[model samples]
Target: MNKFLFKVSFIILFLFLGTAKTFAQKLKFLIPDAGIVQHAGSIGYFSVGAGYEIFKNKKGYLDFNYGYVPAFKGGELHAVTVKLAYKPFEIKLSDWAKLYPFNPGFFLSYTFQEDLAYKFHSSEYPRGYYYWSPALRPHLSFSNEIELSIPESWDGLGINKIGLYTEFNTNDFYIVNYLQNTSSLSLSDIFQLGIGVRLKF
Candidate 1:
């Protein structure tokens, strides 16, 4: 099942990239402004996706992602994520570089699974036994990003800029768990670290 899902993700990415240029020329809005990849966020062990700035000033982004976790690391899992991010401020370092001090985002992740919410709410468990849905997770993140100018030689590919970012994130479930068991769980226990790169076009 994991293999099949992996193949499907690859196929979808291939198709999206294959049609990107032609679509960009005819329907500019249909093309994504950037491609993104992240490692070790709450979404999964690894994720790859595309995104576009939601605002003309490049302060916000709306992204769609596909993520996977291997069996050895955890249970083999597949997830799809949609994220909205906003950067309220930035500093210019030079003509070719800029820094965003505080980038905050909210994301929803849906994992492929049976409906655990129904089971939790049924006779097997008491009412309100589980307040959160296992299949869908909501997460919050704070990130810092550095943007760099791409070389002019790569213009034909439509590539425009490159960004490297560091992220700290926590999900609703983790936060609640930590709040309930503060002694057993440290503040760091609820937080996750992720690093990613973005290629802007």
Candidate 2:
């Protein structure tokens, strides 16, 4: 299982690097933006990465992040995640404040840890006993963000905008469990909340 995971991770890293190289070649003049996240679903305790804004108006984005989980929590976990998000419309509250009512997205993450198995079966168990993999986690979420613009004159830095966002998410395993026991499980039991920030360049 560990060998399989290593192969998978290597392939994914290769693909990601290839894609990033192509994107950079296509947009030679534009610089990629970066952000930091904390406690996001399937992204470990904290993450930092770079991303590119897509589309003519820059309403969509693709991000790649590397996250870490400490040994004290539940052994050490190192994760790589790729996320895509879209903001359809933005509401201007004022000159300095803007609200993005909805930013729906999905993320795929893989954790490097031997203790967590991709399959849950031993020689004693029959075939197809447990189907879900704990090492590879996929999540879907909806979020809202409030952006506050920073004036260039206040600080000569290149950062022009900062955003605070909150997301409500659910994983594949949680959804499957919820479907099997709808009578016992509540919505809150299957859902998780994550909050983070974005800095625009």
lDDT of each: 0.88, 0.83
- Model 2 residue 6 CA deviation in Å: 49
Over 100-125, each residue of candidate 2 has an lDDT whose tens digit, in order, gives: 99999898888888866666657755
Q: Write down the TM-score of every candidate.
A: 0.81, 0.78
Worst 10 residues of 1 by lDDT: 113-122
Instruction: Tell me the lDDT of model 1 at 25.
Output: 78
Q: Write the per-residue lDDT of candidate 1 for residues 5-122, one digit (tens) a residue.
A: 9999999999999899677778867789899999978777999999989988879999999999898995888889999999999999999999998999999988875543323556
Regions of candidate 2 where Cα sits further than 4 Å from its true position: 1-30, 117-127
On the 0 to 100 scale, the lDDT of residue 86 in model 2 is 94
Question: lDDT (0-100) at residue 153 of candidate 2?
Answer: 94
Pick the TM-score winner: 1
C-alpha lDDT of residue 175 in model 1: 93
